[model samples]
Target: MHKEGKVVPLAAATDRGARTPLPCLPVLLLQVRDKAALQLRQGLQALFDNADDTLFEMADKAADRFDQHLYFEAMRDLRLKRKSIERGFLDIFYDTFARIGQVDPLGFMAANEPSRNKAQMERAASVEGMVARVLSRDGLALDQLSLRLQTLLECTLAPQHNPLGPAALSGYFLQAGRNLGVGLRVKLILLKLFERYVLRDIDVLYGEANQLLAAAGVLAELPPAPRRRAEDRRNDSRRISATLEPDDIGADSVGQAFFASIQGLLAPARGRIAPRLHAVATAQPIGTADLLRLLSHLQHYVPAAQEEDDFDLGQQLEQLLLRVSVRSGTRRRIATADEDMINLVGLLFDHIHADDNLPHSLRTLIVRLHIPLLKVALLDKGLFSRASHPARRLLNEIGAAAIGWETGSEGLRDSLHLRVERIIQRLLNDFTEDASLFAELLEDFLAFSQDERRRNELLEQRTRDAEEGRVRALQARQQVQQALNQRLRGRVLPQVVVQMLVQSWSQVLLLAWLKQGEGSPAWRNALATMDTLLASILPQRDPQALLQHVPGLLKALREGLASVALDSTATRDFFQQLELLHLRACAGAEGPAEVAEVLVAEDIVLAIAEESACAPLRQPDEHAAQLRAVQRLRIGAWVEVLDDDEPLRCKLVARVDSSDRLVFANRTGLKVREWTAQGLAQALRLGEVRLLDDGLLFERALESVLDGLRQQQVH
Candidate 1:
């Protein structure tokens, strides 16, 4: 239109329509760990996880969707935090904030926008004052007011405030800001002043926010909160009334709902189906004493199992114990993590440990209570080899204590100085007189032992499952290796191998060689071939669409074939066949480097898939059996596996720890055999396992695991 001399005034037109930008937090500056970017990305993903608006494609592009201004605000805040390395300044700042567990800026901004409006007006008014003097009368025009107003906003401050910082005004504006240039300028000035004087500085409004967050965080930290969702508040109130002194019930206005819930719970129940519930409406932070009382109250409603089973409380009791087990205790400070965790664990353990208080028969039931919490604790601390310490000790104690209690009767003996031979005799004498009470005591002990046994079994089973999973992964890789082997034996063509083109050719070669390309053909040729193969195969697998995962599958196959266990020719031949197949399938053009961006290989399966290798790291599912239990464990618990070592030589993951059998996922059955306070030292130690990004280490360890499996199969 401009070329045709239509004179469509772009700036004028846009300026006419441009509404004033609302006061908003700058886009959030996320913590970047290269390792932890995934976490930031995940949190962002959750913000748009629903069907409303989730249009981000590239992880970087997601920045646009975030309020960049808010992010800039955050970045500016971080800069003010301290002079840091720009190379990774954002990452470092965010990492520190994340570790400190600060609220995400965007979330806070969204939730508190109305709260920010007043502050924005004040800052804008300050700017309006300064800009008033500078504006020519011509700048006062209604048509150009918006354009001229932007000029002051963009002005760099005179060595006092950065351009990104709002400019302060000496005076304020009350009205007509859009129509009058002087008023607009004054308003802008005030906006800047507010930012500089009171608003942007976190100290001003953080106290109340902190208080609110602390209450929510503590409640979230407790495992029992979620399950109590369905309970009647009236019933809960009654229960608490029965147990809590009247003064204790209403000590906190913050705990009013809690009291109400207590009152409802203790209200006389009609029958077995209508026992009391526990309080939950209160968001007040719970003290240790309060938690214990709540736990006791919850236990009261669990309904006896059966009339004669001696374990009176049925599934309700079992579930209550499970709920209690989920949140081990709140994560307080790391220095006292051990002490706090030990005390909490000790409280529960000691409760069961005392046979006289409850009875020896209930030990198994206590063990059952311990299971879900123990699992959840592992999840929280699993990523850091260092964090696993408390969990490991906890597990070990359970095992050791169980063995000790079962054989020697320490818990029971403390309560009643009786021999194992006389335990049954004394038990009948104490409970048979009151058949119902006797059943209650007997069931308690039975539940204790049975639950402990179940817990031990669950741990042992999880360990075995993890071990077998590692073995299966190795076997799956070996199947590919065998295919390469047949090709190497002259039964298959050398042109079949495809990895000569991948960047990780060296690693791939460790598993098997590409037969098609001469040697290390540019990854470009392999990519072209890959594209061609994908396009062609797309038609064949159209109905099935297995090719969607082919890229990663291929990468895994290459990794399997590329091995350097000892410069064996068999490995070379295995890869040759892979090369031939790769060439036949690919498009014959190079693949985009963009593939490297998203598909940063994190494990063996990913290593080969140049474009589809990496998978997003998952947080523990709250509903999943893990996170709902224990949390904030120290990193000093589990054993570690490190570097490119062979099996048995592979670093230990977790030994028979006195702490607990901290669970690990061994994709490659490398046991805990390394040392250092941080973790595996190479890959980020996740739980008991290492998540590897280093290609060489990945291939080497996977190969070692595979070789071990091959030998085992042969034997």
Candidate 2:
């Protein structure tokens, strides 16, 4: 029992001398158990009936274990079955437990003892305290008190090694009934007292503890509390500021104080600004009423500043306006439509009302522009009131354009705002003298918009034309190269000479072939001259002399083509190609003195044999071809060298130059090596090197060296 606001341990109550066994103790125990079982059965049947499969399963499982008196097993099965049912079923289950608790309080307390011994003891003390408080006026009998204390101890202090079995309360009642020497009537009255007080106390304590846990968000057994209204949520969100300490301000204290002061100053105009500010804060679109209210409040600022000189009202008002202006500038950058324009103004007022992030100095400068802006709106409400209004559009455009204005640069920020102010001033000045200025402004804006569209259209057309011309020129080059390759087939010539002819003269061929029979008389005559020059370079002619004529022949071809009126850009491109090819051919010819390696300027040869014919438009599998070519290169194999900026020339690999460089001999038999092994490997990978088998040629050379070595040995 609990006394003097403290829980007196059950051990203290049990210290009293033991009582003799009570007569008919067995009958009393049977009566309490029967009553409890009857109440539990009636409650479960009424609640479930034929409805719940989980309840039916529990009944079946418990009935099978009835021979063993496994009431604890029945309760465990009930817990398991309850998990599979709807959440609403828990209410009926707890109610049934409550009804059973009324029939046998001690037994009910034991059965529901918390799984943890510590928690069960704490709960027993709490229930004991409640019972003591309720029955303080009517003291309990010693025997009754002793019985209740024993029951509480049995339920709470029971060793929890296997709590899943029958309640320890049963053992306590059995031992007490055997020990106590009281009659059946006295024992039955004590049992009634246990049911009335201790059981009722347990229910009250359980309910209170559950409520506390649920309120603290620790218990999920109960339903959640109702949600707060929207207004309440907003208030709760803002409540943190009330508890903010001075130390919390830190470096941003000035900004915070300035905002607070602005809000205080604007309290007088709250009637006009509050509704508009709320709409903006909630992200709602602004309407005409909001705009009109904003303009009225802005008008009050100027007069208030003029009258309150001592208060520095003008400077404060200026600071407020500057803050609004800066925010408006930010909003303008993202505004896409008319609603955005209206929203911009609403947001500006909201910032001013809240004094959000505004610096003191900027706020002053901003105040100066307010009167001019307001006057323009008064002159033509469309200026600030409507999104599509020309004035509104102009301001938005200026704001967007000024987004990138750097404040660190000298006068840049000032210049941007000045330009905005000048526009406002112009509108105010013109509206006072001539209302027609609005019409002129609208007309000028439309004209500027029209001009921008035209410029964009022109740019797009030019881009398209250039792309088409590029594609056409590529097609023409491909067609001419294919035709020339076809025409040169089956001719025997040096490979270098053949390559030179194709690279240097492909452009001339393209022009002549494209203009043939399609141009004027002059172009036709030029084409004839080009064909004649091309025909003179046959494989039967001296290859060296024909190669020498290449430069002079190319110059004549260009002059003749120029005589025909061709597209200037096309003609320029053709000559550029010719120049590049000429430079490369000249470099190759001048580098080596071997006439066998050079071909005459007029000589045109088809070096590709029948077994290894070159397909003009057919691209080879470069990677596979290069790998095969690399495999064919023996110690003294002859090969034609290919480079990005140099013309083709024959070479012999002298030896491996270095780890990363390759050595080769020029056509004159001179060492002219400067190739990197990695670069050579890449060229080989791209199939740039062409293998020329000269095994027999090298065999004879080797034989001569062997004979010379034998003679030296004889000497």
Candidate 3:
């Protein structure tokens, strides 16, 4: 059967097979009306199943709708009905009338009046006439004046398309007229009444209903009813008209009866959400998924204008839902931090949204902070309730400062976002129970943001100072290196000794040089002394003997610095570093204790060549000495193989043969020579060769050579 524009399939039909098939439209209409009325009663009974006396009284008045004017008059007579009808049942009545081709009866009535613009003015004149008549009498009841004024305001402000019409203006005058005879207190009372009833917008009234339901933990249960198609409603109207004569059934009665029926349909469905939510919130534990579902249901009620104060109340309930809906493994009780975070978020949400004065761009930026704020709350529950907490104050300060922020300031907005993100990251990484841990950092950041010009000036100054300091340190380092190199010229030294001196003393020399002015004579003398001492130390034939000189060199370094007139503070620091280096080198040696003891006991070790008087005390077997020399060879160690001509300084590149013979490379790791350890030892015994411990100097020098070899092999 075609109901609305679409054909009603048998399965989709709301009512079917309830009675015998009928050919007559009137009989079918009677049956449908009886069924609809029965359903309506059932719906009403279910709706008021748990209702209180006040709700029952409301339901009783609401069910009486046989006569249209009488229903309105009955409602007007009841004080509670006036308030409750507007908030609760007015929408329902509008829906019923709209379904039957009437759109906003009150609006239609005012619009259809003769002289539409002057209708409210005429009404106000009539009300003023009555009020004036009452006042002229020797004794006049204040109630009469109050009632007349209220009627005038309602007529003036009653939901009209043109609220600025003459009627509304006259109503305003009538309201002010109440104070003519009454004292100031009664005037205030009349003003409050007008504001409370006449001036209140319908949206606010609906929001209040939503808020109350939310507070009672039943908002999720009462989802908005599904609207029927206009065509289907027209068909229903046609059926009602066909079934009953105009005198037999009034349109007002049908509408009132239809409202009761809707209540029944809504009752069964409304209970579903509230019971489930109550069960989860209070009865049993809920998982994240369940909580998310509940949030989904409640999200329908969260008004789009979330910046409003009442919207925050909804958010608070959402946060509470999240708090109670703990994941498994949690302690079950909500944390103090969580409560603090919820409260803080609520405050920020209200503050940002309520501030319509803020620039749109800045308001947008602040609104984006909600997610991060929520994350912080979830991670650390203590953020919710604390007023003076650092994180809490920081967020509040950001919002407060952002209010005066201008549009087009992307840099400032980005910086603020970055700072908030950084704080969030810190909270996530280090979840401290104490809120004061971030106090200093937050305070400094807040101070930095508060003063714009000073902050920029300070930042620029620091940047310039940092660059200057870097250049100064670099120049000092170069000067120290140049002085050492100049003093070491023409002095024959082992490559290993030169490299070690450079590695250990480079930083120390740079620091010492930095302490004095450029080209200072005293600093030059210190560098010259250091160079002479390093050049005098000869390469020991024994690698172990080379290790023994480290402690003595460290000691001489301290003495030389103390004797020189340099910055004492810088000198002491450099000396301490050298001492630490000595300890590390000694530890690396792993040699006999006698070697360390000898180095410690002797304040100085004189440079002794291999050909000196102490050279040949007791020579080991030639083969054994050669084996010892081969054993001491490290892959990257530098060595000198003495020929009849000039000596060759080369790095030990690789072991070519399994015996003591090895391949040697120059500083670039390119094969320069290859020979047995026995040949090198013989040269060493003859004072023509020496082993050099140059540390990683040769290894770094061979980087390019190794890369070249790798490329060649790849080809």
**In model 1, which regions exceed 4 Å deviation?**
1-251, 254-257, 260-476, 479-482, 485-508, 511-715
lDDT (tens digit, per residue) of candidate 2 on 1-715: 2212223233222212112221121222222323333333332332222122222222333446552234334334434543233222222322222232223323434665556466445545544543453334222221232233234223332222111111222222323333334333233322332323233222222233334333433322344323335454334323321222223211233323333333432333332322333334423333433443444454444432123333332344334434554566521111112222233233343333233122222333333334434434434433322233344445444433232222333542464445544444455444342334543554454345334434533443443333334344555565555555555555554444455346544545555544452345643544454454545433323546646776676667667545454466755765555444444444554433332333333433322212211212122334554545554455334455444344343343333322222344432333343344344545666556545433221122224433543455566
Clashes (backbone N, CA, C under 3 Å), per candidate, total 154, 25, 17
TM-score per model over all chains: 0.20, 0.24, 0.18
> 1-715 in candidate 1: lDDT tens per residue?
0011223232322222123332221111110112222222222222222101111111112246444343334334333422222223233323322222222222322455566676555543444443442232112221122221122223222311211111211221122122222232233432332322222221212222223323433122322211122134334433433332233221223223322332332223212220222222221233433333333443333222222332332233334434544464432111122223322332344444443222234343443333223222222322112111233323332333332222123534532213222333333233211223322333344335444544544454555455444444444344434433422333212222233323233343323323323244533343334444334322232423444655665564444434424244655654554444344345333422112112212222323322212122233333322221222223222222323342111212333332222333221332333222222221242443332221121122224433543455566
Root-mean-square deviation (CA) per prediction: 26.7, 41.4, 39.7
Better of 2 and 3 by lDDT: 3
The prediction achieving the highest lDDT against the true structure is 3
User: Could you arrange the candidates by TM-score from highest to lowest?
Assistant: 2, 1, 3
User: What is the lDDT for 472 in model 3?
Assistant: 64
Candidates 1 and 2 compared: the better one by TM-score is: 2
Q: How do the residues 1-715 of candidate 3 rate in per-residue lDDT, one tens digit apiece?
A: 1111213233223233223332222222223233332322332332222122222222334545543333333323333333332223223322321122222323422455666555355443453443343223211222222222223223232222121212222243333242244333222323332322232221222333333333333323344323335454344433433332233212233323433333332332232222333434434434433433443344334333224434443344445654554544332322223333333344445455445444444554455444444544444433432333355556555544443233233644566545644554454444333334456556566555645423443443443343345456656666765665665445644343444345444545655666667677646655655754553343324547646665665565665544444466766655554444444444555522232211122121212112112112133338567558767777656665555364455656555343334555543334556556666666567666567534221122223333543455566
